[model samples]
Every structure is written in C-alpha cells, then in structure tokens.
Target: MSLSPDVFTYVADLVQRRAGIQLDAGKEYLVEGRLQPLAKEAGHPRVDAYVRDLRVAERPADVQAVVEALTTNETSFFRDGTPFRLLTEHIVPALRGPNGSLPRLRVWSAACSTGQEPYSIAMTLADCVGPDTSVEIVASDLNTAVLERAAAGEYSRIETNRGLPSSMLVRYFDAEGTGWRVREQLRRQVTFLKHNLLEPPAFGGQFDVVFLRNVLIYFDLPVKRQVLEHVLAAMRPGGFLVLGAAETTIGLDDGWERVPLERGAVYRAVPRVPAWGLPTATSPVPVVLPAARGPLTGAVPRTAPPGVLPHARPAHVPAGVPAPVIRPITPAPVRGETR
Candidate 1:
C-alpha cells in the first residue's frame, strides 16, 4: 500500500530525532521497503498501517526496530574505491609522528554500516605500513544489529565478490560453505562499538584519520555541523577526514581545510575550539577555487549560490569528463523575412 503523508512524517520525525538523519519527501519507497518485513511480522497489511499503529502506542523495542530498519545502510568492501585510495596514498604518509616513524595510529570508521569498510581499512593499512607500524581501527555505527553482524566478520559468496579483489581474498578470508569468514588476526585489528554522532565523543584517544564517508548527506545543515563538531573533537589536529564523493564540509563548517588533491576530496581538521566545534585563530584560511563551467542561472545571478563556501562544488569532477556547456540560444530566423 502507498505510504500516507502522516506515516512518512512520523517515521521521518522519529529517525531525525533519534539519529539526526533527514528523510525528506519522495523517500516513501525507501520507508516502505525497509519496514515491509517488520510490517508483515507485526500482522499489518502495509507499512503505513504499522507506522500509524506505532504513532499511537509504540513500544521501546518497536521504536528501536523501526529506527534500526531505516538506518541500516548498504555497504561493501572498499565501497566507493576512491576514499581508500586517498587513505593509502596521502592520509597515512602525512600522519607520521616525530622522527618519521609510524606512531600508534588510530583511525575511526564512523557510521560503518557493516564489516567491509573497516576490514578494507585494515587491509589497506597492512599493505602500506610494515610490521613495525602500530595501527588501530575503530568502527562504529548507531544501529546495533548491523554492528553485531559487522563484528562477526563473515560474508556470503555474493557479498565477498563486491569490490573485494581476489588476491586479498585468498590472503584474508577463510573458506566456508559458499562464503568466507574474516580471519582472526585481521578481525583483531578492529573494534566495533555503538556511537551517536550528535553527542560528544571520547574514543580513548584522538584519532589520526577518520572515514566518515557518505553518511553526512542524510543530515540537514545543523546536524551536519553538530556531527562534524563531535568528529573534530575526537580527531587530532591536522587529522585527515575522508568524506564521500558527494559530501563535504564546505560552507557547513569552517574548521575544515579542503585538501587540494588531484582526485577525491578530503578535509584536514584545523585547530578548533573543542567546546563548540568552532575554529580557533590558527584555523587555516579558506582557499576559494576557480569558478566552475557553465553560465550562471537563476535570480541570484552568480556562478554558484550565495553563502556557498569558496571551495564549494561537487566534491570532484572526473579528470576527462568535459564541463557542461550552457549553449546560447539564437532566435529562429523571422518566418517570411528570413535574411
């Protein structure tokens, strides 16, 4: 059954309040898909009905199930492929401590939906640094079910194939029936926990690199700022933050410096006031990028919108993809009087 407006609103509100994720309109398909199973199990004919019932007299367990259902994310090994590239090439090298030694590096994988992301990180780190480098990975998500699944470190045959290369597969995974389980040594490198980004974070010690990719787009601007604040507090000064290709800190938070790279966008945490997530005097000055292609549109009459950060634009435009052209229109020749 089609989701009604009231059902969507209630679900959206519940998710936003508890998880800081925004569910704007047009996501009825998503709401219906995730909640359909729950709705069926609850003996409701449709998700909208289940949600309506939830609004009237929701139990704590039901609420938890609803939020977890909606917030459960789809993730695979090395996910987008580029952020891990940035991590391997740039982030780790630059994070070396005094005397050029790899310190006990801590990397947090926030909102890590399942085991793949953190395992991917651990694999990359193992490949880059020798046995001497001390590495620790903390993978956390708000949803407990996914966290439990992630911590188990197992994958089906289909799950193993996605974005995971064969060489690493042979080295890292133990053969099981039609699938594989992550070996003990690799699993030991990561620790999974439950964390809400909206609250202050204390993860034992400051992290040197954080993979917060793709999770920010679900938040409204204020929640984005709040999460970034909490993330910054948990990171060491000059720590690297890898956002999803479509996500960024531009214009939302001034405490991040956009690291200019040939490919993929990553932010470096500038010195900031931990109390409020505001930048301190030592915060790096913003560097406005050159204007993007295409003629300006809309009443604003600007290359981009006002209040957009100087560096603001889609995180990356592919190397050879030509910039979009705003072709000028020439009026058709006047009918009978054509020259």
Candidate 2:
C-alpha cells in the first residue's frame, strides 16, 4: 500500500526531530516499506490506520518504535576498508603524544549501527596498539534495539561473510550455533551506549578520534550544521574526525581542517595560534610532529591550500593495491525487517 503525503510528512518530521535524519519528498516508498511491517505487528490492518492513531496521540513507546523502524542501520565489518587503513597506518601514528609517551586514544563511533563499525574499530586498535598503549571505543546509536544487538556482538552467517576475512573471523570470533559471536576479548574492548546525534554529546570527555561516517548524508543542511558543531565541541584539539567519503565540512563548519590521508577521509580540529607566533590548542595537540605543524598551525582557512595534499590518493585502487572492496555482499537487512 502507498503512504499518503500527509502521513509521510508527519513521520518525516518526527524522525528529524528525534534522530536528525531527513526524509525527502521522494522517500515515501522507503518510509512505507519500513513502517508497514511495524504497523502490521501493531495490529493495524493498514499503514495509514496506524499512522492515524499516532497522529491523534503520541505514545512514547510507539513513537520510539517508528523511529527505530525508519532509522537506517546498513553496516558491515570494515564497512569501508580505507578508513580503517588510514586509521591504523596514518592517523594512529600521528596521535602519539610527545616526550615519548604512549598515547591513550578515546574514539567515538557515533551512530554506530548494530556494532559492526565500532567492533571493526576495536579490532583495528587491538591490532595496532601494544600493551603500552590504551584505546577506549565509545559506540552509540539512536535506536535502543540496535544498541542491544550491538552490545551482544552476535552476527548471522551472512553478516559475518560480509567484509570479514576468514583469518580475522577465526581469530576474533567464536562460532555460535548458526552465527558468530565476537570474542569476549574484542567485545570487552568496546562500550556501546544509546545516544541521539541531534542531542549534545555526553560521552564524558573529548574524543581523540570521532567516526561520524555514513550518517550526515541522511540529515538536511541545517541539522547537519548543528550536528557537526556539537561534534566539533566534543573533539580534542588536533584530534581526527572521519566522515563518509561523500561527506565534508565545506559550507558546514570551519573549526575543522581536512587532514589528508592516503585513500581515506579525515579532518583535524584547527589549531589555534597565539600572538607570540607559537601555536596552542584547546587540548594537547597529539600527533602533530615537527614536520606536521606547518599544515596544522595557524588559522586554517575554509579551503585547503594547494601543494599541501600532493601525497593524497583515491579511496579505491585497482588490484595489486591493498584496498579491499567493503560494499555489502547482499542488501543490508532492510531497517524494519522482523528480527
């Protein structure tokens, strides 16, 4: 059954207000498709009937169910290979504090869907950091349903097959009946929480690295600006922000300076310079080595300077290159599919 414009608009506004996801005019099909099952389960014979009930009164639990149904949770282990590559090879190394101190990294995986993204991050850090180093992963999603699944760290066969190598799969996960469960070691490394991106961050303190990828594309311009501003406030100076390859800070905010990395997208908080020609930051600028200061120092402009990104490369490359294709093997389980 088709979704009426009135119902669609109502659902769209509620979603935006609660989760910061924008559903444009043409997305009625997507909305109808996701909500129909929920409506049926709610004992409404038709989507419109369920929507009518919702319109007449706001039931907190029912509202949450709709938000969960509409929220997109498509994700795979190492969803985009390049981000992890850049994170381990380039960004992590740069985050090393001076005086030969071992760096402690606080990473926020915002809007983490079903835990794959954050677990993938934990695996990468486990591989990169030694006993001397420490990494804390904070993963959050707006949907409590997904957060529960994420905390459990169980994956169906299809889920494990997507973007997971046989080697790492065996190393990090134990087979559980039909699906696989993340090993206690890896699962313990990440702390999952329920958080809405539309609200201010409350993960205790600033993060050394923030993964807000693949989420901003769902938000309108104004909401995107507001979300980015909040993310900026939660970042430690000179910390890295990773966005989806399709997302950028251009026309959104100027507090971040794009940090060029091979085959990956990353942004660094712009360092503030004092009158003495010396550079200072809100937090200790971790990872900005002597050679890296020139690019990160001074008041960064809205646009990146030329010749600065001479070493930058594409996110994907042909065979003989190490980049792995991370797109899903099957359509991600549609958001509203019954568990």
Candidate 3:
C-alpha cells in the first residue's frame, strides 16, 4: 500500500532527526518499496500503520532499521579508481612522522557499508608497504547490519565480481562454495565498528586519512557542516581527506585545500595559525599542490576498468588466474611535459 503524505512526512522527519539523512517529498515511493517488507515482518501488515507505530511508540531499533534501509550503500571494490591510485603514488609517500620515519598510519572509511572499501585500502597499502608495516584501517557505518557483514569479509559470487579483479580474487580470497571470503591476513588490517557521523568522534585516535566520500549529499546543510566538523576534529594536523568527486570543502568548510593529482583530487587540512606572528607548535604549513582538474562531476563515471564497477558486475567469470603484482599507479604525463 502507498504511504499517505502525513505518514511519509512524519517518517522523513524522523529519519532526518535521528540519522541526519534527508528524504525528499518524492521519496515516498522509495519508503514504500523498502519499508513494506519491514512492516510486514514487524507484523504491522502496512507501511502507514508501521510509520504510525514508529511515531507513537518511538522504538529505537525500528527507527534505526528504517534509516538503514533508506541509506544508500552503493559501493564496489575501488568504486572510483583515481582515489586509490592517488593514495598509493602521492599520499602515502608524502606522509611522515616527526622523526622522519614512516609513521604507523591509521585510516578511517566513514560510512563504509561493507568490507569492500577498507579491504581494498589494505590491498593497496600492501602493494606499497612491507608485510610488517603498521597500518590500521577503521571502517564504520551507522547500519549495524552492514557492519556485521563487513566484519565477516565474505562476498557472494556476484559481489566478488563487482570491481574485484580476478587476480585480487585469487590473491586475497578463499573459495567457499559459491562465495569468496577475504583472507584472514588482509582482514586483520581492518577494524569494523558501528558509528554514526552525527555523534562525536569515538572510534579512538586521530586518523591520517579519512574517506568521507559520497555521503554528505544525503545531508542538509546543517548536518553536512556538523559531520564535516566532527571529521575535521578526528583528523591529525596535515592529514588528508578524500571526498567523492562530486563533493568539496568549499562553503561548508574552508580549512581544507585541494590536492590535484591526475587520478583524482584529495584534500589536506591547513593548520590554523594564532593571531600572533609566532607559529603554533603542531600546525605545519600546508603543502600546495598543482591546479585541480575542472570542477568535479560528483558522479562516478560508468566507464572505469573491469574490476571497479560502481553499479554492476561482469557477465562472465575467469577462474584460477594468479594475482598479478600490483604496480604503483602514477598519473598520465601531459602531452608537452617531460619527466
């Protein structure tokens, strides 16, 4: 049954209030489609009745479930290829500690729906760093349901086929019936937790890199600023922040400056200086990067390489291929430029 306007408004407001996600007027159809099964399982038999119960009873679990259903978890291995390449070639090399040794790096995959994003990060780092390097990846999502799946690090055949190269499949996964499980070695690098972006930072220490991509579009201006504030607080000085190609730090926050690499852009935080002329203890002068590509489209391009599909998987599968050594990805040279 279709949701009445009043019920839809009530439900939409509830989601915005609780989870900071904005559902527009036209999203009643989406609510109807996603919530009908939940309603039936909840024994309401109708979405309007379920929404009414949600309003009157104010059950926390049901509210969370609704928000989770509404939240888009659309992602794939290397969802955008440029970000991973930029990470390997530029960001990791640029990172250094006070003593000049490569510091133990901590990365946060905010809104990480499942294991793919974080695991992909680990795979990228593995290609660059020695096996014994100390790197930690914390993957968080508001949806506990997805967090559970992420912790397991298992994907069905269809999931494996989405942006997961056959080489990576053979190298990083163990065959389990019709599914593939992320090897324990790779899984150990990432930690999964349930987290809400609207809340204060609680996932432990400061991060060197925060992947806050493709999530801010779901929030209104106030919520977007609030989440960005929290994210800024969670990052160490001079740390890097990567947003979706469509998102930027303009207007919402001015502290981040753009780093334009050919693969994609990443942002680095500028340390705030005191009114006095003297430099603060921790604020390092920000490094300037080359001019960025023209304004980003905010949409993931459909024509990425074989393993990094944002929407769908390949129709056929190749089996038993050995994983190729992942080479460090560099930017394509300019036509008139000499290295």
- Per TM-score, the best of the predicted structures is 2
Question: Compared with the true structure, what per-residue lDDT tens digits does model 1 show for residues 1-339?
Answer: 679988899999999998999998999999999999999999998998889888888888899899999985889998888888888788888887646688588999999987799999999998998888888999999888899989999899899999999999999999988889999999999999989888876566488889998899889999999999889878877899989888889999887999986567799987643242222235332222333544334422443334433333444655444432222223344688657
Clashing residue pairs, backbone N/CA/C < 3 A, model 1: none
Question: What TM-score would each prediction reach against the true structure?
Answer: 0.79, 0.81, 0.80
Query: Taking the tens digit of each residue's C-alpha lDDT, what string does model 3 give over 193-298?
Result: 8889999768775788999889998999999999988888888777899989888888888778888766465888765554332232344443221112322132
Point out where model 3 deviates above 4 Å: 97-100, 280-339
How high is the lDDT of residue 204 in model 3? 74
In TM-score terms, candidate 3 sits at 0.80
**Lowest summed lDDT window (length 10), candidate 1:** 323-332
Q: Rank the candidates by lDDT, best first.
A: 1, 2, 3
Report how far residue 279 has shifted in candidate 3, in Å.
Answer: 4.0
- Please provide, for model 2 over 259-311, each residue's C-alpha lDDT reduced to its tens digit, 9 standing for 90 to 100: 87755669997754433322233323422223222343343333323322312
lDDT against the true structure, each candidate: 0.82, 0.81, 0.80
Models sorted by TM-score, best on top: 2, 3, 1
Q: Provide the RMSD of all predictions against the true structure, rounded to 1 decimal.
A: 16.3, 15.1, 16.9
